[model samples]
Target: MVVTVPRVSGQVRDALAAAALAVCAAVAAAVWPEVRPLDAPGLLLLAGVHAPLAVLRRWPGRALASLVVLALPYHLLQYQHHALVPAEVIALFGYAVLGRRVRVVLSVVALLLLTCVVGMAMRAGGGSVREQIAVIEGVVAIAIAVQVWRSHRARVAAITERAERAERTREQEARRRVAEERLRIARDLHDLLAHSITLIGVQAGAAAHLVRGDRPVDRGELGEALASIAATCRDARTELRGTLQVLRGADGGPPEVLPGIAGIAGLAEAARAAGLTVVLDDEGAGTPPPEVGVAAYRIVQEALTNVVKHAAATTVEVGLARDGDRLAVRVADDGRGPAGGSPRGFGLLGMIERARSVGGTLDAGPRAGGGFTVTALLPVADVGSVTPR
Candidate 1:
């Protein structure tokens, strides 16, 4: 088993570091031959230099300033200068890494100049040139390293932000696709059930009327009505099964062939069976892309369904014509429009969505002459040429 170490807080870590540095400085002052003995004043000065380190990260500039102020007094009082050098180095590192660049540069330059002047004054004979050069070189090297580290940290932060943004975008795109698929499935279900059930209901109602009449029941007509119901149910079951298989992504069989514009005749025939006179006028509209074909077929189907359910008139005219790259489909009924002002159902919305999905447009409204009409304009050219709405 692997062992996990508990994390240490920054404040606790800083306090421990400051305590260790103070102890080491005290030990060095007591043992080192070059250092003077620690007096009460000298011990106080040492504490002042190292104690600020505990809060260095929280207040880098202030801690650095405190170290400089105490260090000057320690040096001027002739205390062991080497004992507190480590603390001064730690303070300088905190300021270089955490303080603003402009402020750090100014503070470091002022401190270095002050140190050089003080050293020169302390040595009446003047200090060695090599020692001054070494000190300046060390400070410059530290500054360069700090700047490189800061640059690397900034780059890492930027890269992480971009990755997070990309992940969010991908998630949003996935949700949009899922929503569209759900809507497509809902439309399919509505069209299949609405058309088949309405026809079956009409056939069943006719058979009931025959049986309930005072005269003897017409067995021949009743048999035909029952057969029609059976046929409609079988077709609905097959289509539903195919839809489910497609949704399951089963590779056991070939994909189901969706009905296209050519299948509009079947829609008209079915409507006629339900007692509405349907007129289909096909003006040699050439074959369209699969998406456009499917969209056209569904739009016509939904328009017919709306008429059967809401329109009271007996006849509906479905016209198809081709003009250049456009395919026009119109479904007109000599019936009253929606009982109310306009249609308030998913059928109309589904038809509109289907047309728009294939970069087409559909309009439904009451005709001035009297009746409801749905007109759709579909592009017969390559689907890629049209921008989806």
Candidate 2:
């Protein structure tokens, strides 16, 4: 259905003008013979009220007061019947449309009361009890109009506030639903992909051992492939668990630390099993806090995994050094070159994100002689201690 737009201010102006015009015509008709014939001054005063009534909303009290004073002499000279007129009605409407403060209304009403008293005392010809009653009735009409206008304004304001509150509530609910969906996806990735990749490393290591010296596959190549699988699994687990914890709720336990400097030996062992010559060197052996240590371990692990996946290096080297408050890990491969010698995608991005998440930094690129190198620095103290250096 179509709806028409309303112009409230324009409508108010038109209404007030129409009312004033009617009153002017009435006064002219009732008092024309008694005064002078219908002419310029009479018609002009009658039309003047209508023009100002359009601006009554902008200046209600002023308009109302001006009209009352103007009406006085017109009534006195024309027809002093102590009767209600069109101008009086328009003045009343002006008071209602003005939206002035209650204090202002009270003050204006007090003036009207004084005017009523004086008008009664002066009492124009043949103006008596009946005339006084008519004047009182006009004042009553003005007061009622003011009250009705105030009530309409208050109702409109209340509705606007309610609508705004409802909109905010809906937006919050949408965010909550989106968060829940993310957690569900995280749980699926953890259970299905992370666990599957881990098993691939175990199987690959075994396959390399079984094929030792007789097959087309080099035992060392198989071992490096397995090592890469294991590292990928660990990284996936860390990312997946972090996501799922949000679904479980904010009250979940501290983050699961994937292994740190201490886990370097395990990494070396896995790489060896896969047949790649691997070495691990630690400059500082102090145990670090779960977060920093985990970040450090993951950095080295991912770098080593990348070396196995992309580097043609037969030997991988990992070095860890702690300087003052910081711990740094460096992983390098002395291989033919990166498998395709082209760096791409999530491997490097994940390493950078892991380092940044724990307030650390990472650098990865090609080495001078050949192969690829990755260097990472983690703030051990900043992330808190897992164990003392």
Candidate 3:
């Protein structure tokens, strides 16, 4: 069986050391021939010097002062001197390692003065002045070495903290970018599927109505409805393929051409196929920046999708005009505004996010006259280039 010995705490070890030093000083005072015999006052002074070692780390300034105070009398009264030097060294080392600069300087000066007084006393008792000078040098060396070690440890700790802070900042930025990319992809998928599926549903319904009617089915009308469904499916497939390419991180071909302001006519045509009269008015001057154009196209697309899906009205007017440095887009439909009062849905939220992402604003609400209107003001000039996501 292995016997495990518990580790001693720093305070406990320091106490043991202090007690051992006290015992040693007492023994030396009693038996050493060159020093005076141990007495009550001398024993008290020895205790004062060694006892502070037990708490040297916790209170370095106090410990060093205690040692210096008691050691003076011990040396002046000519008690045994050698045993107390170890305690003095420990005290000085503790203060240098932990004490503030002003206190350390003051303590060092006090200790040097005490050392000079001791050397003078020893000289009168026939001790060599050279030995005292060497003792003073040793004390100075210990204080300087401890201070250098402390400074080096402090510098290392500061550098480690800075590196850790930089790592955390990088991680936070990466997470933010990932979140933005996910939101952009979701908006794209929603707009693509919603428009295509809504159109296909409307066309399929028309074809079914013609077949189930009591009158003989109109073959031309039936064919037109089927053709619209087929065309919508084809467009949806192309857009899905492009989106998939982006998801797979492929750079094999020229990028998919995104629909922009020019694509509004196509949207209007699709809505017209769904049995709505669409009036498109384009009053814009020159072409907008690609980012602005894409935003405009998506907002119009989403607005029309909402109209076809929910509006019972038969007419929608889409207007695009340049107002100074901004492009104004407005979509209005004679629809049963929004069901149950407020205009709230994921489609509207996505449109708002897209507008704000390019430093623009969108307002959507029911017109007081009887329909819903979505109006967006997009910057047309000097809108900084954006990477397609």
Candidate 4:
């Protein structure tokens, strides 16, 4: 098993520093006696080489080479029983493991072991041959362990990085799918609820007109109004049920048919039936794109809905014109309001955002003469090309 420095909290780095210094001092003590009977000062100077080895990872190749170079002076002095085996062995392991320099590590190991063997033979020291062999074996084991540990660490780091990147990618894709689902649901609600309400408004007006001159009330007309209302309610309930299923994590249903300019006349007819007089003046020469047609439909829908809710006006005007390359749509209501005053609510804001989504501009404010006006300008065609509905 390989021994690594644990990433512990509080006093760990300081503790490691002290432990390494102590270990180096102990090694120096054992090797000091071997180089006695020679200049004590020179041997002390040579032992100081181990100081740089403590910071080996900070400068691996330089420290390893420096340790070997410092050992040469003791050999030249012919110091008694001087052994460079321990320092050279540790330096080789450091180079191999942390520095990952296999060639340099092997070369250093062979050179140092050969020097120790030759020196032992030349000196005729009293130390047992078994003890020297044991030291060589220990160093070889350490070098092998360090090599294995380094390889494992590199593989682990690579796997962790790839996993994290994949996780992020998956999260982004999930969010995008969720957002598209919400937009689909919104479009569905607009189609079903809006269509059903406009139908109810039409039937209600017809029933009210048929019984208007009756002495009390026509039971037949009342029954027809109630029947129409029930059908509208049933249709809304069916559409809302499907929307609720999607919200509860079910796969969404089919797309709903959105209204375009063809439906705008129906919208005007609905308003006229609901006791509001609507006059449409369409002056555009060219056919409008589908997106622009949809925008025009929605603008009129919102304007009429607001008139039903807030405006007590009897007459409204919707105008459409092609001004050069742009399609201009305007809805003006003769409702009670000061000219140039702001209207409350997100109704206008919603209209503006819808226009902007299709690369268009929208403005809504009180007209100078009487009531409120909403005007929008959209591109006649996107890049001179039209998208089919």
Return the top candidate by lDDT: 3
Worst 10 residues of 4 by lDDT: 75-84
- For residues 218-330, write the lDDT of model 3, one tens digit per residue: 99999999998998898788777877887877789865677788878988988899999999998663698878988998899999999998888889999999988888999
lDDT by residue for model 2 (35-90), tens: 23445565555555455566566777777666666655444444332333555665
Residue 83 local lDDT, model 2: 31
Per-residue lDDT over 299-334 for candidate 1, one digit per residue giving the tens place of the 0 to 100 score: 888889888888887999999888678889899999
Selected candidate, larger TM-score, 2 vs 3? 3
Question: Can you give the lDDT of residue 337 in candidate 3?
Answer: 79
Clashes of 2: 9
Q: Give the Cα error of residue 17 in candidate 3, in Å.
A: 2.3
Each candidate: RMSD? 5.5, 8.7, 3.9, 9.0
lDDT scores for all predictions?
Answer: 0.79, 0.63, 0.81, 0.65
Error of 4 at 383 (Å): 6.3
- Candidate 1 matches the true fold with a TM-score of 0.78
Q: After superposition, how far is residue 20 of candidate 2 from its true place, in Å?
A: 7.7
- What tens-digit string does per-residue lDDT give for candidate 4 at 1-389? 99999677434553465346535544554555543443555547445555556667677777777766665555434443224556656676677766756655655655675576566546545463444545555655666676667667778988999999999999997888787666545654664566567657767776777778657787875786767667657756765675566566565566444456776776786666566889988756256876677777777777777776566778899888888777888888888753247766656665776676567789887777777888898777662353221
What's the residue-level lDDT of 117 in candidate 4?
Answer: 52
Error of 1 at 251 (Å): 2.3
**Residue pairs in collision within model 2:** 23-86, 220-275, 223-274, 286-389, 288-386, 289-385, 289-386, 310-339, 313-335
